[model samples]
Target: MSQSLMVAFDVPDKKAALKLAEELGGGQGKTAKVGMELYYKEGAAVVQDLQEQGFAIFLDLKLFDIPNTVQKAMLQLARLGVDFVTVHAMGGKKMLQAAKRGLEQGALESGLPAPKLLAVTELTSISEAILKDEQNCRLNLKEQVEQLALLAKAAGCDGVVCSALEVADLHQVVGDDFFYLVPGIRMANDQVGDQVRVATPAKAKAWGASAIVVGRPINQSTDVKTAYQAYLADWQGSEQEK
Candidate 1:
């Protein structure tokens, strides 16, 4: 796998997402994640077209349902040739196992590489205060991330979607081979939006995150391509900073 970022296309519709994907590919990279809204409007056609154009697609639906329902959905998602997909870690061990089993069965039936399944541990919108005050917890932000990550791993998940803050410690905890797809990444001067745990692109890279999931910073930019370049440059600068 290349050390590339997966920019998310959270467009209002699939048409916008397709156009955005083309703009981002202004050849800097060849892949993007298609999230819920776009996928709903365009259906699997969005995934098929991008894959045809050589974009490594992350079908970021963040699937969460019963084990059987999720398994069935995974089987359908498999046929579309997406490079990666997301499931919720809150679903627990048995459900995660069912997802794994579902994916394997799908691969055996389809005869293709299975999409890498990533567990979404918690939403980036959540804060330490929210966790402690709202969720009734005592652990700090980093500790909570670790706990959920461990749960996902013990349940046979391939990777987890974590916020930038804990990726370094998690890389140490979960090992390099276990994937970490981090989001809530805002630039040094960017607005944090609804997200509470964001880091700059450089910080995410130093944390040993396998990939960064950036949205509004790039999507809402006056020039999406320029924003993307800044992110790439920030990531490239991470090594020197370290």
Candidate 2:
């Protein structure tokens, strides 16, 4: 597979998402991310629509239920022909294993490529302060992320949705081939918004991220196409430097 830069289509509904998808044209090297809000509103039809439009769907539902429930849900999502899907590593090894099994089964049944199962370590919106104080954790941010990533790997997950700040550490521990999908990517001049562990695109690529999930910097930009192209340039330039 080619190196991807996923534009998060985290809009309100299917109509809005399709509008953006039309403008961006998921051709080039771009991929589309469908998160909770839009997926809940539009469901499988939205997935089908995007696939038909030539976009590889990165379904970001972050499944975090019991083993049986998560397995069943992944089984269904697998049939959608999504290119990527997320599950929370906090759900433990059994749940991740169950999810992997379900995804494999679904792919086998449908005779389709199984979506890469990415395990969520921690939300980029979360801070070290929040992890220590709010979440009541002893481990620091990097340690916690590393631990979760190990568990995800042990359970046969293909990759992790980690903060850009933690991607290097994860890469060191997990090595290459275990995907590192970093989120919380923002342009250097852009405001951070709700994200706490943000990094610029160049920084993310330098840290060896497999892919970066970018949202508002492109979506909310005044010149969406130019902004999107600028991000693509950053990633390409970074790769060439490597």
Candidate 3:
């Protein structure tokens, strides 16, 4: 897929989520992210609903568990036929490997292509201070993210969910073949909210991000389509400028 924008469905229920999706043209080659909130409330039926509406789903459960348990969980997720899924890179190499294996096996059985397994590096919510103080880690924030990304790639993941702030360095370290799906995107004038590390869609594109996940800036707007189009414009850049 070309560099893309994935609208995050961060609402409380399926009705709200679907409404937002419909306002954005009911998918039709677009992608939607069903994160913890919506997924936990509505379950797999919502994913199927989105698929039927022609939305490619990114099921961001961020699974983290022992290798066997994670593998079992991934097996079930693979059967959903989502375009992407996430697991915590902090889960270690064994768990990441097991998760990939489960997806492969489950997709084969379901006669579907396995979702791209994206390992979550450090959350955009985590600041450098939090990394040193709360996580009690030796590595600095960038170093830690880079380390986890290497671990994920070694374990057979197709990509990683990371901050756009780290994309340039990660591209250097992890290479272009690995997908860098960034989240925590905010426009220049947008509020930072809970995310500490954030960037505009234009910066993300310039830094070579494979894709971006956007939420409140579009979702909370009074005019959702206009907000989405603005983001897409920044992300894709103007043809005249290009």
Compared with the true structure, what per-residue lDDT tens digits does model 2 show for residues 1-242? 23378888888988888888777855444588999988999988998888788888899999999999999999999998999999999999999999999999999999999999999999999898999999998999999999999999999999999988998888888778799998899888889999999988888989988899889998777777777778877877734311
As a TM-score, model 2 comes out at 0.95
lDDT (Cα, tens digit) per residue for candidate 1, span 148-210: 889889988889999888888897887778989989988889998898888987888887878
Candidate 3 wrongly placed segments (more than 4 Å): 1-3, 239-242
- Give the winner by lDDT: 1 or 2: 2
Off by over 4 Å in 1: 1-3, 26-28, 238-242
Candidates 1 and 3 compared by lDDT, better number: 3
Best by lDDT: 3
> In angstroms, how far off is 36's CA in candidate 3?
0.5
- Prediction 3 TM-score vs. true: 0.97
Best by TM-score: 3
Each prediction's whole-model lDDT (CA): 0.81, 0.88, 0.92
Tens-place lDDT per residue, model 3, 1-242, is: 31279999999998998899888877876889999999999999999988888899999999999999999999999999999999999999999999999999899999999999999999999999999999999999999999999999999999999999899999999988999999999998999999999999899989989999999998988989888888888888873211
Question: Which of the predicted structures, 1 or 2, would earn the higher TM-score when compared with the native?
Answer: 2
